[model samples]
Target chain A: MSGDIVIEAKGLTKTYGQAVAVDHISFTVGRGEIFGLLGPNGAGKTTTILMLLGLTDISGGQVSVLGFNPAREPLSVKRRVGYLPDTVGFYDQLTAADNLRYTARLIGFRLAEREKRIGEALDRVGLSEFAEHRVGTFSRGMRQRLGLAEILMKGAQIAILDEPTSGLDPHATAELLTIIRRFKTEGVSVLLSSHLLERVQSVCDRVALFSAGRIALMGSVSDLGREVLGSGYVVDIEAEGSGLGERLALVPGVNRVEQTGIGKLRLHADRDVRPEAAAEVVAQHGRLKFLGVQEPSLEAIYTHYFAARPDGTLKEGARHAA
Target chain B: MRREGSAFNGLGVVMLKELADHLTSIRFIILEIIVMLIAVGTVYVATQQIKDTVAQDPFLFLKFFTTSRAPLPSFIFWLSLLVPVMAIGLAFDSVNGEYNRRTLSRILSQPIYRDALLFGKFLAGLMTLAIALLVLWLLVIGLGLLFIGIPPGGEEVARAFVFLLVTLIYAGVWLALGLLFSIVFRSAATAALATLGLWLFFYVIWPVLAGEISQIIVPPDPRYMALGLQTPGTVVLEQFLARLSPSTLFGEIVVAILDPTTRALGPIYLSQLQGAVLGAPLPLGASVLIAWPQIVGLIATSIILFVIGYVVFQRQEVRA
Candidate 1:
């Protein structure tokens, strides 16, 4: 709800040997917002996340988490930041309660405080009943919940999760989104990076689109949709004659056109030109069986921005295109 | 900010948790079972041998007991040799496994320092080795009493106690070595392999190979070689090659415990030791005094290795 920044990075870069994994990228997440870092695989999203948590070295640039420099003040910064790695990798031999208890103790929680926190966190993540079970025997979703339980036990002000819902089922993913939503309501700023755009869009208030090592486009979901397409509609049409409306719909900036039947067509075109196109279709071809406008999904917008780069890198040029 | 005392509390927490981890770990369980089996098998075989030997010639006991001052039941000798191997096995994966499991990052993220992590692991390892050693010692003493019917003299007790101290310190060296290897090598399997390789090299392979090298380096003259070659060659060659091994340093300590008449040569007079077979097998006090440097060297080596590990761990990157 507030515009206050929880994490801020400027010209952040990380390079391993000859390859630059995360180029000089910059972004900020506001307080209490679920900020998603959306990118395809090998896009440096995880690298950027690590840099924010002070887990990885910063080859160049500066980063501050909760107003403390992550490099110089890692302990202080880490005190208020909880990180969930890609795979979770809990101590498989330890019971969930034991694992959480161990982590809680490490973060300097009082024994009494940790006891309560452990119980509450496990309950919140819906693993309360399975707290006594070894993590090795837990299902993937249960392990994820335990990982969340560990993070929540720390009582961190910010949560940085890398691909938290990657392997979860639809039900588990929904449960995870609910937990993240609850954290957001409690004023915990979350930085979630995943290749799942729909999941990110559902949980996040804002998103930073990453490609290669750079952030290509960053803004609210609606704002990015508006900026990229300026109100585009995906129109599906059914005609009687030669599907000529679908062929003529291939003007510059017109995204795509597909024939659904002998005369039916699906049109992805600019909003301002849709009425003009439809009018021409009526005059030139025939009567239309159906014509409607639908909002552009995040998938369509993501493709429109990412597909331009031959290498699929979302750098400055692709950012401008978006 | 929270108080500073909590940081140490965090360390205590890790220590306790690791202790539990060790208790429940299959590695520790399997090691305990193996060590107990070896100790029981060894003591049983030794008891049977001593009984049969005494029956053959009752006076043989007098010769065995009086000729060498090394306080026996000879169980001490076997115990010393076996303890280090067991200790190394228990600790070889302490740090390396954490790296492999990727749990080090999660654990270190807590308010504890790298030093505390190493210290906690080392302490836990020492405790485990001590416990195992304790069980073996008790069993050895009990078996000795059953067969020999001697409760052991004050000198015997003193020597056994000193031997235990040496065993603990020796085990510390291995624990430290394993930890250092873990830190240097990221993979647990690689660290385990490297540690076993080093153990084999130092304990078995090195001594044999060094003996062969010594023979080639200082071969016997044909005129003097045949009649008394084994005696003079063994004396000169062992002294020279033993100096190359920490195990040799330990072997000297063991010899001094059993035979307390040999006098220890000082550092300045180490050269004088070339042709001289140690006279008046050194007193236990004198052996410890002379071997203090070697003992300290092993301990210091351990400390230095762990310190390097700590530094590497502190600088490593932990991903989210």
Candidate 2:
């Protein structure tokens, strides 16, 4: 990305009475980037989205979307943005096509173009077959897909989806993720929130982890893993010999060593210890059966971040990970 | 260029959608059927009685609305009793129903202003009520012409037209009340029950309460008992208290417009009536002039209630 900012928030703070929902948070989303807001429930993720859309009044701070101040020019901003709320709602009596038609009309689509756009949107979300069915009869996954179809019909330049895969089966979730990926190809910026770290790790180009109404960690999945878990790699070695743990521990960069089986050793090192550990085992006259490097997963990084401190504050080293 | 008033960008769409829904809903259809049956049935009975009296009555067409048969009431009375029920039914869920369905936030998130949603709902309800009243008015007029075999004069038509307008204004008051309750309450059932409760209180219990309050405030003097005349102060106080209810105001306007012989709604001096003919019908303009205060009261009440709903709805958060 060329750093062409599409959304910017500076000192964005929201307080409902004495409780601070969002406090002095700032972030920017680049054009055509899929930015994931990863947070547990009540971490202020939904509040931040509402503030960006101007659906709720800001207690204090500034936000701009598409170069228009959302607080002052909400209609102009809203016209260019699409929002799928956490609990997407539709008129139960109306069919899927009718619901999309209502939204198209509200967005000021003319009659001639509305029908074509609705068709294209429904087809994109894989809901073309159920277009004539009332939404009340739809499953949770179908309704979520219908919401995506509505956003598509609007042709919104910016799409903000909250908990998009919530209440969906594994297959439905995979289908939704694929559709979300297409938004980037079309050059539409997407900001989606989810509590499922695995889902976010799979699709997000960059993510901000929210904890206690603050961004505790933010970066690409690999960068976050390295920052929170330390600059290290695990090398697993299987050798049909004795004394391999002592031999691997003598390697200069190896941090720790563990035995898996009678002839297995797991080496934690800050650098690529695979070559050194393999050569050392061979030198010891041991038959090296298997040797592999294990990179830290996002789940480990998340657990490390939370388990690292009691105050829910990010460690100093992880602050600059973004 | 974009429209000058973008705040109301989606107003027409919302209004048209709501109006279509109201017209097609089962609740509105059932209410329309019941109201029409009662109105037509009473007018039919009144027509039978008026047939024998038409030879002597000059304003026989106006009698279609004001004349009563032995067991049934007049056409205007049935309208006065049923129009509020229809108006309340149409709007009691206008705002809260959207919340219950979880569509309020989604709709507000569109490019439209919050004002547009409430305004469109109120306007749509008023339009539906107006259309129903127009149809009922035409049906009665058509039946009158068929039974009496005489076309109404221009003056009679003008008077009836003004009466129809006044009736619509009266219905607007209740529609506004229903909308206000809808905005104040979160549940559709609670808003509906609250509106209906207010309606019943005003329609059935208010007159008796107003009379009792007036008697306590301005007691009748024993000095005038032998003359068998009501005290002017007590009567005025009672009428003023009763006018607080929209139904009372509507009833007064109906009487003045439909019954042209009604010289005044308040006290009339003996000197003012000396040269006036006893049975002469007032001109359409004069009747409207006499009931002008009542008409203004109905309109002012509707506007007041609408403003309250607008303010409350604007301040509300769209989270729910």
Candidate 3:
């Protein structure tokens, strides 16, 4: 409903026969944000994306993209959003230029501007050299780049990329992420879905960890660390004397106090409480050594949320952060 | 916020792409060659028949071009058999092949509706068949002038043109059948095989099987067989069942074109031709109009098949 909201879905659900794909879930992506939907395979990420694109019928709820209902107003939503599906295929016999030209014409671009726009799009994706070659002969990375080029040609306010860097090498992945970042700087909102946590962590400002057909956690990277992992800190200390473990556990908001080996305590405490716990430890045991606190990584949070799944099988609403 | 006819626009865009692909593809080239082969082969076979008839009786020249028989050597007869096969082969894989190649989803993503793809392909296939038919007719007329030493009369040319139109409709019937098969079958090869199987059933197997049933039902009353003894061709027991086949309808259209005195079948040839003159051209317009139902049936069948394909395509999900 707001200008900043690029995508809004409320109670969206899809079922094929008896199997529920995406079930009663809601989320929103604000403008100029790299929002990732993190889920493993068959977690309904693709189904949710398809429903948002108006390509699949939804059994329940509603979806609005760019302030238009994708089901009833797909054309409008499609016009404002560029989508790079997991894989993009082209007319195998046609040259890349011809393919792009055809796509341009289909989308109602004027013939006069087609050549120029296609050239610019290819250049943007670093695929200008392969413009005249048949797309069938293209490598996997080249096809991915071309798919990005097609999306760029849409000139959309929002981009929905479903695993954009799925099959790419490290170099290609970095290239695609850089292009996505450039779009972000240009004020385009991005909704990317991927199982690759590292890729999502690097490119996204915020992420939704999907599990059991819902967002288990959703928020910005740092917000998640500070809020969920308590300022991203963990303390592991080696006690020098008796009763050090019990003394550390007595601290307020100390989550866990574990004894590792002879006179060692690994303390899991909130970041704010860590300083106090350490102060108390130093006061009581002067011979204490190996006292340190490590910041929690995105990987750690991802695993924590994934491990907390009640059914032990991650669902679509598995995104967790913030 | 602004959703104005993007699906319609997508359809148009997709149609243009599909038409271009069809026109330039190897499949079209191969189909064209196959059609040419059929036309040439028919012409060659007919020339041999004409030469043998002429050699048997030099005085039968007047009856050669005009006859009231059920089957004759007119251009229409040859067209009836060849055109349907051509149409079937050209279109059988049109839609299913795209699905098989995983190109339908990709193509659909480009601002086009499903209707455009089906309609565009249908129009293109018809156009291709029209071109082939026109060339074949020209070749036939050219050969007739070269070998017969007589330029065709106005009525002859009119009849020939009407026959060409009939052939076009016959081809349309097959195109519709092919499109239907394409929609029903997922693989292009399977679609093609299904169309061929249908063709074989209607053209060859069904009629023969029906003959046995009809004979058993009506026990070949000696009276009926005796009455038909004077008929030029053998009246098989399956004659009634055979009439339901498309091949039969097409054959009737051909006979109507060649036979001037072909009136209501109940009357004997002697009475039917009582008022008709020898070597006169029949009213071609009246004959086509008489067979209008069959022509319309073929056209309607084609449209229905295409509509089914269109609906199926639009409803299908496009995966990456």
- Cα-based TM-score, every candidate: 0.80, 0.90, 0.80
Task: For residues B160-237, write the lDDT of model 2, one tens digit per residue.
Answer: 899899999999999999999999999888988999899889988999998899889999877656689777788899
- lDDT for B266 in candidate 2 is 72
Which lDDT value does model 1 have at A30? 82
Model 3 score (lDDT) = 0.72
**DockQ values for all predictions?**
0.31, 0.50, 0.32
Q: Looking at candidate 3, what is the lDDT of residue A235?
A: 80
Tens digits of per-residue lDDT for model 1 on B1-320? 33233334355666677777777777778877865665555556655665555454322222222222224334444555666666667677877677667677666655555667878887887877777777766766666676667466565666666766777877787777787787777777788788778866787777788777877877756766666545456447756675566576666665555555445632224575677665434445776776677677667766776777777867766552
Over the stretch A47-136, how does candidate 2's per-residue lDDT look in tens digits?
A: 999889888888887888999887888898888888888778898889999999988998889998999999999999999999999999
Model 3, docking class:
acceptable
Q: Model 3, DockQ value? A: 0.32
Error at B70, model 1, angstroms: 18
Give the CAPRI rating of model 1.
acceptable
Ten residues in sequence with the least summed lDDT for candidate 3 chain B: B59-68
lDDT of each: 0.72, 0.87, 0.72
Better of 1 and 2 by DockQ: 2
Query: For each of the candidates, what fraction of the native contacts does it recover?
Result: 0.47, 0.62, 0.40
Give the alpha carbon lDDT tens digit for every residue of A177-247 in model 1. 88989999889999898999887687788888887788888888877887775646567766665657555
